[model samples]
Target: MELVSLNATHPDHGGKSFQKAASVVLHLLVIAALTYQIRGVARLPAHPHIDARILVPYAPGHTAVVHPPKPKIIRPKEEPKLAMKEPPPPPPPSSGGDPTGDADVELAMASFFPDPKPDLAALPHGTRGDIVIDIVIDQDGKVVDTQVDQGLGHGVDEAVLAVLQTWTFYPATKSGKPVPSKQRLLFHFERA
Candidate 1:
């Protein structure tokens, strides 16, 4: 036969609560101690007798002082004061040589019709005449402009004009620089 005893209040429950609180506090203290121990190991050496002369401040009178003579900005010497005067006249050139004859523009080479005669069928059958073209030779020895000074009927003028467009010339020169020079070119076409 067994008898059962039941009580609502138990002292063991309070004791277990106290033990749980103490265990938590002890665990926290241990963790804190380990953290501080690691931080101490990682810190830099705290040397007590280190020489600090490099960090010392300079004494008041120890700097080298140089007092230079009052600096005078030297200025350029002024030109002798001149009363406003007219410039001197240039010397006259000698009259012995031809001034206009300084450079002669002989067409060192003039562009000409590669073929003076074209297919007769291509041209209208008629009296062909001569056409004089005026050309302006520009710098760089290139023919820049051309105009038909004389026009001939029978397709002669257009043929001459077309030929002139392809022509080149040695440009006129003045002071060794190419200057535009006017030249006259004649294209003669005679019907046989």
Candidate 2:
């Protein structure tokens, strides 16, 4: 058998000129795309100039001086004083005289007891009443016992009793000698 040429430019079959032209065109297109991309990357955006003096190394005798911020001082403002009226003086004690008919024994006065305002929040608004309590004062001028003869409820009675227990009284005197005595106290509670 004769040797047959397998060259791409053979005349028995159509030459591959179309393929060669297409390859040349493809190569040209790739070169064009690469050049376009490189040209776009070569351009740089405008930016502000930065001073690099702080990055410089300091010399032996020339040192950089840095100052710390000063501290702030603050002062408090004064509050205004309010004008309020003083409470009225307590009433004098009743002169019911001693039950044993001891003329020398003086009864306890209303002023001797402290005037602690009861917590009226438990009671209705504008509620007012009297709470009578009988207290025994020892010869040492301390309340030894207390009995609620009358009470204005809503926890007011307990509050009053607790405050009275801490009070120190002036003991009664019989023939100029200190003696334990029993006295009745009247506390009037009025809501303000």
Candidate 3:
């Protein structure tokens, strides 16, 4: 019961042959710092130029010099000239009569009718006719343009041009100011 002595030598430590010569000088200073970092990474010049190419098996005429990659001219960016200030000369020719000349306009007074009658009950059970629309009212009385000019299909001319585009007219005049006329709406789609 007394065999314990791993090459026994210890004056407080510094002994097994000075710890085997300090572990062989710390393994030769870690192999001389790993051979000075592998000779400074083998003198450094190998970033990315390794063309050891030797693939020669397609022998018929040996044509592989392909170098078509130099067409990148791309040049279209010239757009910065916006000083246009000549649009103020077009609003002085509007004093009453030739508001684009509907030629003496004067017949557009059916004030507003958000939906003044056009449900003909979805017309189909007999669908009588008559849809004629030609509107164009606008001088600010809106009804800008309808044009159904006699349609009466079972859809009742698109429900009387969608109820005459929510009709809103009273702007037809010429010698008396507000112009822009032209109105001829007669929608009668009786479908009892």
Candidate 4:
């Protein structure tokens, strides 16, 4: 007994293999034609056109569509009735000595004119003179008024007055309160 292999490479089965391959190719060609015919039927020839128009309503026969009335115009009213209360009267004049008689006044005087003695440089050429300035020390410990009693021609008199203006004193007191008092300062100028 002889055995025959059915594979395409086997001599006995080569012609049969060729016939089977041809039938498979013919089946694929028929399937491709059917797919193309179905796709054509599914497509429409032309797209439909749509005409769109936006319509607004026109007022007919004076139809009154009332809108809310405008808010009322309000004017602020003047309140003249409101009045400010008066400030309490100044605290009764402080008790002890004049409140104005404080250490600050003395410090201010010292800072204003540090040198109590007048500089004699103003007098020149052997000029010598004595000046007495009548000064009033006010309650604030400041020299308020200065009257020159003697004159020194070489500007010595004026220099004395100007320097005294910056002088301050423990204003004379009466009954523990600062009081204005008259005092005199004597300046002697003699060139060295």
Sorted on lDDT, best first, the list reads: 2, 3, 4, 1
Extract clashing residue pairs from model 1.
none
- The lDDT leader among the candidates is 2
Model 3 segments more than 4 A misplaced: 1-65, 68-110, 125-130, 135-148, 153-171, 175-181, 184-192
Query: Quick one: ranking by TM-score, best first?
Result: 2, 1, 4, 3
The runs of at least 3 residues in candidate 1 whose Cα sits more than 4 Å from the true structure, single-residue gaps closed, are: 1-108, 111-113, 116-128
Report the candidate with higher lDDT, 2 versus 4.
2
Per-residue CA lDDT of model 2 for 81-129, tens digit only, reads 7899999999766544576765666654333566767779988888888
Candidate 4 lDDT over 116-178, as tens digits, reads 455667667577777777878788888898898876756666666777787767666555555
Best by TM-score: 2
Model 1 accuracy (lDDT, Cα): 0.60
Tens digits of per-residue lDDT for model 1, 1-192 = 876667655769899999999999999888666443221122123654552221122344564343333655787698677699899999776422225666433332564436555344545566566678887777655667889878665566676666667766665555555567777877666555
Model 4 residue 68 lDDT? 40
The TM-score that candidate 1 achieves is: 0.39
Off by more than 4 A, model 2: 1-103, 108-112
lDDT of each: 0.60, 0.72, 0.65, 0.61
